[model samples]
Target: MNILLTGGTGYIGSHTAVALGQSGHEVTLLDNLSNSDTAVIDRIAQIIGKRPSFVHGDVRDTALVRELIKVHSIDAVVHFAGLKAVGESVAHPVDYYANNVQGTVSLLQAMQAESVKSLIFSSSATVYGVPQYLPYDEDHPTRAINPYGRTKLHVEEILHDVAQSDASWRVACLRYFNPVGAHESGLIGESPRGIPNNLMPFIAQVAIGMRSELQVFGDDYPTPDGTGVRDYIHVMDLAEGHVAALDYLNGRPGWSAINLGTGQGYSVLEVMQAFERANGCAIPYAIAPRRSGDLAAYYASAEQAHKLLGWSAKRSLDEMCASTWRYYQTGV
Candidate 1:
């Protein structure tokens, strides 16, 4: 199958591209290089043994997407293009809406026009917002508090409506938890443009001497370590989840929302300790006031993922840290 990845050069998209390539599928990457670098395409080629086709454009351009779909004979699309920063989304809701929400709508329209209905969306656990339950399942309530999350939820709503309108549409909205780690090859990984927003990158920078120390946000949370806890899934596992989702859409013709996580929760301190254990380097840190809207503890119920896509995260925290350290130290 020929697959188009919207933010194909970015972190998760790049890994998914490799997964799709290894899974015997033609991959085309469409990216504008906003939060990612073009050199990533070279790194992807290094890992995949051949360069998947790449298009430098925005997903909001309906005509361009249509052209790519037609020219590549795209069988399905994995939408990942968007502004993903939470604080930035709060300050610039319009950009978030324009890029994340509007871009997806444009992609759907282009797909509809081209008679391509299969899609695997890169949704986030943020769409679940404040956890109403311990392990968030697909049945969890979705009241996204932040603009970044709302953008994802808005796209999900649109997808549900689109699927309801057409029985031929096969869609999977994989709500991902904190996606960390790098490919075991250390060639392709998460490379945020500026200061890293996620915890793992921030810790990686601190460990690599690029950053001074980490901020242990709100050490007074009700967790065991008095810090926020989260489910962190390795990037490769997340990538394989995409491959599973695409396969599930082969004949299954209904919308399915699945969680891509390890169903395990680790605190901020636990992650730092694990990173130190993984790479044998101490991460300097200082506890700071909790960021607004941070939950104390939350993870996923991976049963649906295993039951539906036969996929579950298999990488350990040590592997997540080790691969990330390898990328930062050895990645070109």
Candidate 2:
């Protein structure tokens, strides 16, 4: 299959590109390089032994997307292009809507124009808001707490409307949990511009001595460890989940939503311990006030994804830490 991946140079997209390449599929990476670097394409080529076709553009450029779809004979698309910082989204809601919401509309229109129907959307667990229940499933209600999550929910809603209006389109919305770690090769990983927003990246920076200390948020949560807990899935497994989603979309019909997670939750302190174990050094930390919109604890059921896509996250916390440490060591 000839697959067109939006935001293909970003963290998850880069790993998914490698997974798709290894799965015997032709890949065309479309990226604006807003939050990512072009040198990532070179790293991807080094890992996969074959570089994919690269396009420098935004998903909001409908004509450019249409031309690329027509020229590359793209069989499907995996949409991952968008601004994803939750706190930043609160301050810049319009930018979030424009990039994530309007971007999807443009991409869908271009797909419709080019007659490319299959799509795998990168949705988020944040769309569930605070997680009404532990181990959230596909049926969980969506109530985004922030503008970033609202953008994801909006795109998912748009995909549903498009699917209902057109019978030819096959769409799968993969609601991802906390995606962390890096490829084992240490050639590619996340490179946040400033202070890292996610736990794993921040922990990795601390472990590598790039940062001073970890701040454990809210040591009085309702969890066993008295800190916020989350499901951390390795980037490699998350990458494979995308491949599974694309493969399922290729053969299956209609619209469906699935959760990608390890079905396990870990607290902030537990992650610190895992990183310490992986790095062979103690990570210093202090308890801090909880972030404004953080949930007490939220993982995923993951059963639906296993049954539907034959996929389940398989990496341990140690593996997540070790792989991330390797990437940090080489400065990837």
Q: Best candidate, lDDT-wise?
A: 1
Over 1-332, each residue of candidate 1 has an lDDT whose tens digit, in order, gives 99999999999999999999999999999999888888888888998899999999999999999999999999999999998889999999999999999999999999999999999999999998888887999999999999999999999999999999999999999999999999999988887878888999899999988889999889988889898999999999999999999999998887888999999999999999999998999899998998987889989999999998889889999999999999999743
In candidate 1, stretches whose alpha carbon ends up further than 4 angstroms from where it belongs are: none
For residue 321, give model 2's deviation from the true position in Å.
0.4
**Model 2, runs deviating above 4 Å:** none
TM-score of each: 0.99, 0.98
* Candidate 2: tens digits of C-alpha lDDT, residues 86-173: 9999999999999999999999999998888999999999999977777788898999999999999988998898889888889999
**Cα deviation of 48, candidate 1, in Å:** 1.5
User: lDDT at 297 for candidate 2?
Assistant: 93
Clash totals in order:
0, 0
Minimum summed lDDT over a 10-residue window in model 2 is located at 246-255
Score each candidate by Cα lDDT.
Answer: 0.93, 0.91
Q: How far is candidate 2 from the true structure (C-alpha RMSD, Å)?
A: 0.9
Cα deviation of 192 in candidate 1 (Å)? Answer: 0.8
Which 10 consecutive residues of model 1 have the lowest summed lDDT? 323-332
